[model samples]
Structures are given as C-alpha cells and as structure tokens.
Target chain A: MDANWIAIAASVLLQSSPLIIAVCGETLSERAGVVNLSLDGSLLLSALAGFVAAYFSSSLLLGFLAAAGVGALMALIVAFGSLALRQSQVAVGFVLTLLGDSLSAFLGQNFTRLPGPWVQRLPIPLLKDIPVLGPIFFNQDLVVYFSLVLVAVTTWWIFHTRPGLELRSAGERPEAAFARGVAVRRLRYWYAVLGGALVGIAGAAYSLDVKIGWAEGHTRGLGWIALAIVIFGGWSPLRGALGVLLFVATRSVISVVLQRSLGESSVVILNALPWLLMLGVLVVVGGRFSEQVLSRLPAALQRPFRGLLRAAPPAALGAELKEG
Target chain B: MSRPAWLPRLWPLLPSFVALLLTSLLLLAFGASPPLAFGAIWEGAFGNQDRLLTTVAFWIPLMLSSLGLLISFRAGLWNIGIEGQFILGAIGASWVALSLQLPAPLQISLQMLAAMAAGALWAGLAGVLKRWGVHEIFGGLALNNLAIILTNYLIAGPWQPPEGGSFRGTAPFHADALLPLVGATRFSVVALGLALLAFGLVVLALRNSAWGLRLKALGRNPRSALLLGVSSRRETLLAMAFCGALAGLGGAVRVLSWFDSLRQSISGGIGYLALMVVILAAFRLLWTPLVAFFFAAVLSGSVVLQLRTQLHSSLGNILTGVLVLLVLLFGNLDSLRAWWAEWRAGRRRS
Candidate 1:
C-alpha cells in the first residue's frame, strides 16, 4: 500500500478537482433557490464542445471558453423552461439530459477516436519547491487553482455582500424579497447561467487534465456525482470539497482494486462504482428529514427570489415559477 | 377553455416523418437518390425472403422490450433499465436452460420464466429503493448500471462459456431449446405468438382492470390519487415489476429466436430506444408495435445507408434528437396549439 501512496494521493486530488468545480458551481445555484438538474447534460455538452474547439483551434483558453459557452447555452434551456414558461425544472432538465446524450453521441461520432489537445500544467516557482506539498498542490494545472479560489470567493460572496443579502432574502422568502423589490426571477437567471458556466469548466477540466484525449460519452455521470456531493456537504462550499474528495477517492480505489480482484470483463461491471455510490448517498439523504430541514435551511434555498414561498434549498429544487 | 386533445395529435407524427425522410435525403446528398436509398432500406429490411425473416427476427425483441417501456410509462414511471433487464433476462434464460439440463420442451418454458423473474426482481429492487424515498430517475439509472455490471460478472466469471474468451458469452442452448422461425422471418414463431397474445392482454388490462384505473389515476395526478387513497407506492412498485417482466420476455426471445446466445451488448441501447419509442407512442401500450416497427425500419435503414454510403450512420441519432425535442416542446405548448388551431379555423372560414 505504501508503494504508491504518494502517487495515489496525487491522482485522487487531481480526480476530485472536476467534482469540486462542478459542486462549487452548483452550490451557487442551490444557494439562490434554483437547482439546475441539467448539470449532467451541461457538463457533457460543454466537455465535448471544449474538446472539439481545442482540437481544431489548438487553444486551451478557447477550449475553456467554448466549454463555458456550451454550458450557458444548455442552462438557457433550463432558464427559459423553468423561469419563463414556468414548466417544472426537473422535467425540463431530464429532457435536456436525453437530448444532451443524443446530441453528444451524434456530434462526437465523427470526432470519436480523434486526437485532442493536451492541457499544459503550470507550476509556481517558490510554491513548487515546498517539500512534498510542492508537486502535489502547487504544481497543478490552472483549473485546479481556480476551483479552490471559486470555493473561497463563493463563501465570501454569500456572507459579506449586500447583493448576496438580497439574493438570500429572495431565496428564503421570495414574496418578502419581492415586496422589498428584489428582482427574484432576474437574479435566478443570472445564478443559473453563472453556475452553468462553472459546471462547463468543470467538464472541460476532464479533457484538459485526466483524460487529455477526446472521446464520446466521456465525463459520464460526473455531473450527477457533483449533485450528490452538493447534498452530502449539506450544500456548503467547504464541506462539498470533502464530498468530492470522497467520491473521486472511491472511484480511484475501485478501479485499482477491481482490476486486481476481477478480470477485465468483470472490471467493466465495477466501472460504475462511483456513480452507484453517489446515488446511494442521495437516497440516504432523501430518507433523512433533511428535506424538511431543507426548507428551514439557509434563508435562501428552494424558493426563487422576489416572490412568495420563501424557503430553504431544494425541497423540490428546479421547480417552475408558479407566478401565483 | 380546453381545446380537443386530438386536434393537435397529427402534428407531431408529421414532423417525425419529415425528419425521418430528411435523414434518408442525407444519403442522396452523398449521391444516392432518395427513392433508391429508400427502396434499398425497405428491401434490405423486408424486401426479399431472407432479409424480411431476419428483420422480423430483429423486431421481436425490440417490440417486446418497447411494450415493457409503455407499461412503465403508463404508471408515470420511466424504466430506462429495460436494456439491462433485457440482457439479464437472456442471461437468466441461458443459465437455466444450460445449467439445469432439463428435458427439451420443459427447458424453454423454465428459461422464459427465469428470465421474467430475474427482470422482475431486478426492477423490484429499484422499486423498493424508490419506496424508501429515492427518486425513480436515480433509482432506474443505478439499477441499469448495477444490472449491467452484475450480468457482466455472471457472463465473465462462472458463466463464461466453455468455448473460452474468444467469445464472451454463455454456451449455446440445446438444439431442441431453439425456437423455429417463420419462412424467412427470423422471429421465433412461438415467441412472436406469445407477444401478440401479451399485447392483447396488456390492452385488456389497461382498459378494464381496477388496478389499471389506479395506475392511470396515479400517473395523471399522484397527489390527487394519494388523496383518494390509491396507494401510489404500491402501484408504482408493481408497475415497475410488470414492466421488467415484459422486458425480460423480450430478452428470452432474443436468445431463442434471433441471436441464439447472450453477449455483453445483448440489448445494445435498445432500452434507450425504447424510451424514445414510449415517448413517440405517447405512452400507448398498444402503439408499441407501430412505433418500434417504424424506428426499427429507420435503424435498419441507417445500416443500409452505411453500406451504400460512407457517411456516419449516427445521423439517425441527430434526427431522433430533433424529433424528440420538437415533440416535447410542441406537445406541452398550449399557445402553439391554440395558434395552429386558430389558423386552421380561419382557413376553413375563408
């Protein structure tokens, strides 16, 4: 076990970065009383678009931008359906999932088995020289650095800002916020799109780091795992870091252990451990009274801002605006 | 203020057909005439004696599995794991017929029963999980994966055929265990017969039974059904099991009728296609045949285009995605329907 201890830990951290990015983005959305169920589809489409953009243009920044653009476009579908037409966000999101899958498969069909750009790693001078921590932390790629900062910045935004206060008020009691003149719908749209952009980067992070080559059906269920981590962390940024760490760690362990314990074909069977574990965690969370506690949670959760029915995070997240 | 529901029904079908034709036109875009490509697609699928036989063979399992999809949708459930269930069913049927070494006639009956039971139990696990507070989508997703893995484990481990790793599947069932097909149609005569019978039974059950009423009520409005004490949990669990059994039957027929053995990709995304079929059929259990046959033709057609033209066959996926999007968006749009109907009435007045 000690033979690969340092390497395993390094890979685990790397693997967890995408989850961290996705969850942090979702954390923002959930905090504002909107749940973007299309995180899975958004991550997928963006990941493909990112890979495609970089493959043709050979620009990593453009790849990242493309990912974010795709994410916002996917989120737009959720925003319009849940916000404008007032359809159930969950339903629309599910439809988006199916569409995302077919569209990706169709688009990626030609691109499958094609070569993609390799993301360059940047190491800081002084920090890269720091003992064991140097190679493990400071010598990581750019997204790795942004993911950590995003968490801190999100934490600060929620606790310290004036607009954040109104957003919180909107999430907690939209009617109250509405009476106080907080534009709940507009705020939610922004949060959803922003969150979507973050999730997009999270997807592109895959092609940039772990599996640098492009492929179809890549980033399978990572978005779903991020959603589970959001709930597992109780929708807090700091704790969500742990949940993502735990998920990625489990997946890393499963691959290593199953390869040793089971043959190749059987190993295919166990490839789904990470996703199954996420679903299990979600089921456990749902059975707990946390959903009720969900309403009583942070003042800004399931309810959109600037309307009635102020509540906590996602008792029924991604619900359509009823306009009552 | 509600317009007649049937008024806008034909619109969705028309778009789907247009999309299907345009996909074929893509073949012409590559230099094959639309009619020649269409003719080749039809002939390759059902034109001659042998191709028609194999086409029927292909249709048996797909149609059966799709019917299973309709059953679940009727209860407002999306049993997306039908592909997994279909695979497991084949595995179960193979395991029984081969491992048990039963008499000829008794072997297949037992195998079919085992397949159905495996599917029901697998789906039942998800049902029980949902009953305990898990969402159906998550539960179905998990179970789909779990079933795939578990079946892979079975096939790759103890059930690994005596032939070894060159082929990763079970040993062929006994000769008598195989079902006979119609002249050139690849479908097992008995399996297709049973499916037809099951079709009638499903229609009757949905239309006449007290249980059917309960399911319909729950699907339409679970909250109101709960108020009426319809026991949503129980009905949902039962509906999932029923759907699973239907899918399992399809799996059983695949081995006995078409492929004659199980493989890793036994169901081959048919479960997903079944989801599309259910939506396209508007969750009509009886409409399963019509939709599955139509899509099956499109699928086989794409394969023809591939052999004729070097372009990607996945163009079909893009088209299907477009059709689904239009149907979903337009189906729920009250404003769109009203505008179309108003325009139609205006034309009539003139």
Candidate 2:
C-alpha cells in the first residue's frame, strides 16, 4: 500500500508538470495585466503543431520550438489587439481560442491517430537513488525538471528581482509605472508574448511527454483548468505549482476510485472533478469566508496566513493601459 | 475635397472586406481555390428555397443567443456561462417533454417555460457568486463546465434511453411532444416567429425602456449609476436572469425545432458563436440580427463546403473568429487615422 501511494504521488507530479508550466506562464501574463484567454485553443493548436513538427523532422527539440512559436504568435495577436487596437483582451483571447481550435482541427486532421516521437525519461543517478523523494521528483523527463525549476526561478524573478518589480508594477499600476519611467506598454507586450510562449511549451509538453500523441482536441479543456489554477494559486508561481499538483492529484484519485466502482457513465462525473475542486478552492481562498477566517486568526499568524490564503491578483489585470 | 458623409458609415464594412481577403489567402495556402470555396458556400447557404429555410432555422437560435449576450453586455456583466445555461435549458425542456403529457400547444409552451426557468436558475447562481465576491467570469466558466457534466451524466446515466446509452442522445419524444413543423420543412414557423418577437421586444426595451437606460448607465459607470439611485445588485440579477432566459429560449428552439432530443453537446458552441456575433455587431441592436443571420448562413454553408471540398467544417468557425478579430482591430478608425497622420508627418521631417 505504501509503495502504491508513492507511485500515485509520482504519477500525479508527472501529470501536473505541464499544468504547472502553464499556470506559471499565465501568472506572469496576468501579472503584466494581460489575460491570455486563448490558453485552451492555444494548447490544442500547439499540441498539433508540436506533434506534426516532431513527426516530420523526428526532432523532439524542433517540436517544442514549433509549439513555442505558435503560442507566442497567438499571444502576440492578443497583445496587439489589447495594446494597439485598444480592444478587450478577454474578447480577443476568446475569439483566438475559438479560431485556434478550429484551425487545429482543420490542419491536424491528416495527422490524427498517427504515432509520433515521445520524450524518454531521464533519471538523475544520485537523486534517483534516494527513496520516495527521488522517484517523485527526479525520475522524470526534461520538461518535468524544467517545470520544477520554473517555480523557483519564476518566484524569485517576480518577487526578488528589479525587472520582476517592473513587470508587477506594469500590471498593478501601469500609469504610475510609466510615470516612474518604466515602459509599461512595451513591458506588457513582451510579458504577454513571453508568457504565451511558455503556454506553448506546456502544450508541447503534453503532446511529446504526457499524453504522447496528436488527437483531435488534444489537451482540450486543460487550458481552462490552467486559467483556473492561476486564480487558485493567487498568481504566485509557487502556489500555482501547488495548485496544479493538487488538481492533478484529485483528478487521479477520483478516476482511480470511479474506475473500481463505477462504469463508463461515471466518466462524465469524473471529468468534472477538477473544475468543481477549483471552484471550491477559489471560493475558500477568495470569498468573504476567507476574510472572516483570516480576521479571527492570531495577529502574528494572520498576516502570513492571509498571504497564503488570499493572494490578490495584480491591480490592473485585464485593464487597457493608456498612454500618458 | 471634403469626405462624403456616407464614407464614415462605410467604415464598418472595411473589416469584413479585409477578413475576406485574409481568408482567401489562407484558402490559397491550403491549396484550395478561394473562388470555388466561396461559390460552394454561397450555393450551400442560399441556392434554393429549402436551403434558405435551413439558414433561417440556424438564424433563430443564433439571434436569440446574441440577444441574450447583448443584455448581459449592456449590464456590464460578462456572463460567459451562457453555453451552460443553454444546455440546462435543453435539459429543462427535455425533462418536461419526457415526464409531462399535455396537448401539443400546452406542452411546447411549458417546455419553453421550464427551459427559461432552468437557464435563469443556472445564470442566477453565477450572479449570486459574483455578489459574494467571486468574479463572474470565473464563476460562469466553472458553472459552464458543471452544466455540461450534468448534461452528460443525465444522458449517459440515469436518464439513459431504454435502448441503453448512446452519446447521440436520449430517445426522441412522442409525436405530440415534438414541435409542429412549417409546411414540409424541418423549420418551425412558430419558433422563427418567437425569435422575431424576442428580437423586437429586446430592441424596444433597449431603446425605449427606463430599465434599459438604467442598465446602460450601470454598465458605463457603476458609481454614477449608484449615485443616480440604481441598485447595482438588483440590476445585475435582473440582467443576468433576462439574459439567461433569452439563451434558454434559444436552447429550447434548438432542441424542440431542430434536433428534438437531448445530447451532451447540444449547445454546439452556439453560445460562443453568439458572443462573436455580438462583438461583430459592435453592441448595436440594429446590426445584431443581421450579423447573426450572416453567421448562420456561414454555418449552414460550411456543410456544403465540406461536401464539395472535403475541407473540415471548422473552416466556418475560423472565418467567424478571423472576421471578429479584424472588426475589433478596425473598429477604432480614429486612432489608426491619427497614428497614420503622425507617422507621415514624422517621415517628412526626417
């Protein structure tokens, strides 16, 4: 039983690695005040693009690069729409999502169900020798390690570094940031595109590492979950990683339980678990109930506890930044 | 020479033309002849009386969903969960159709009522969540997923037809429960009339009613609206409920007049498509129904394109997305004009 639990934990981490990447990417974008609502469609399109690129070239690296390109391009459109045209980011992202999905379906029809290359697992020697910790963290593909590193790196960048401070200010108070000589619009465009490229990498991760093939709507609905997890994580990279792990763990457990006890119909209910869990988590974290709970805590504990439980998003998220 | 007054009026059409050009380029890249695809689309959407009626059938639901979205947009509420409300509406209508036995007219009316109620209830949950500090976009998206799951559970589980389960849907309703058709076409004149009536009502309400003015004021500036005696909470709830009702009516027409059964994906992305329509219409009431009809034609025409070119049906959706994006970009011509003038002046100086 202990062995089985460890295996489950490892599997959960592996499954959630891509999501961690996506949530982190989205956290960065939203921090810069742009919401990439195109994550779902972007994921699907990039998955297809990655798979196709890898299939034709037989190069896993090329596949990931292609995915990142697709993702960045999508993000660029969102940035252009929001920054240049002064349109709603949400609306543009939503339309892009639909467009991306359709384009993927149309373009990927020929490649569906075909076998393609997958990332081989690479276990670090010394780390793999460690007991449960080794298997859970060390015995994974390159993307998983990258995701793990991303959490620490992103957290440090966002909270510790000066550039990160500028990024935050761009989202939190664009006009103020501009007044202080920060190039708010340029920063927003760069962050939105960079964040989108990370999302594309997540898509490639799914196709080349996690799910391992191109299929219609491949990685469908997960983009939305990443969006939700970003909110659940309070836009903190570390917390967002944790949120992804929690979501994947819950889904894995529910699927296991349902497979043992229920038939095919239960699959629909199982599919909804992540969404319902995310909703519950958001309510607990963001709702008034959380505020009351925080107020009741001891003064010393309250600040830290509130920080963990109620991390607010950047102030100017989703708002159009105007020229001073 | 002074610009013609009508030139400003023609600005909106520029986006459509640019989108068409871009789509033509895309088609050429795909190795399909653009003119052939365009011809097929036209022929499929409006070649005959039968085809035209089918386009009309598509128009009804699209128009209704757009109207629903317009209401929410006017109230500054982003009710993204209209897709879920639409599904619940179908479930509600299906439940009434299956469980209740009444005369044809009464049954149809009751089914529609039940559908509207179900949609309202679903949308109201999001409104309540918003009031409780949950952002409506997140809440609505979550509810959309939940509603789809619920529909799937019903169709595949407890409410599975006697023939066992099929993802296609539950069994067709009794003949009496089915909506009456119009003159040999699958189209229902009553449903079309209802849609037109709803459109008329919405236009009138938006244009003339105090409630409409209040909703607009609230959307434009909540603080000012509050200062002017508008209750934000009450208006929010009303706008959401009304929007849900319109979306529910769209779902009802889809189920009763078109498919005649419940399926997991009964909403068929109509809710999202309606959003695109609303965007393309630029929130103007007069332009919405026309845009909806144009989109409906694209949808129906895509089938013909599929048959002729063997291209994927999603081409229509791609077109819709491209068109909307272009429209959004071109919507602000003043900014573009100003930028162009500044660039020209700077180039001459340099």
DockQ of each: 0.34, 0.66
The digit string of per-residue lDDT tens for model 1 on B1-350 reads: 77777867656776667666765565555565767666667766776777766666677777878877666777888676676778778778877877776666788888889999988887787788777566666677777777667667767777777768735666666776777667645557788788888888888878889888888999888999999999987898888888888888888888777766666767766776777777766677666788778667766666676677555666555555556555655554564645467557756976
Best by TM-score: 2
- Give the Cα error of residue A80 in candidate 1, in Å: 3.2
Candidate 2 segments whose C-alpha is farther than 4 A from its true place: A292-302, B338-350
lDDT of 2 by residue, B14-132 (tens): 88888899888878888899999999999989998888888899899888889988889999988888998888888899999989999999999999999999999988988988876
Q: Tell me the tens digit of each residue's lDDT in model 2 across A81-130.
A: 87876788888898898889988998897888899999999999999979
Query: In terms of TM-score, how similar is model 1 to the real structure?
Result: 0.85
Best by DockQ: 2
| RMSD to the hidden true structure, all candidates | 6.1, 2.0
Error of 1 at A113 (Å): 3.7
Each candidate's B-chain TM-score, in sequence, is: 0.86, 0.95
Write down the worst ten-residue block by lDDT for model 2 chain A. A262-271
By summed lDDT, the worst window of 10 consecutive residues in model 1 chain A runs over A303-312
Q: Could you say which candidate leads in lDDT?
A: 2
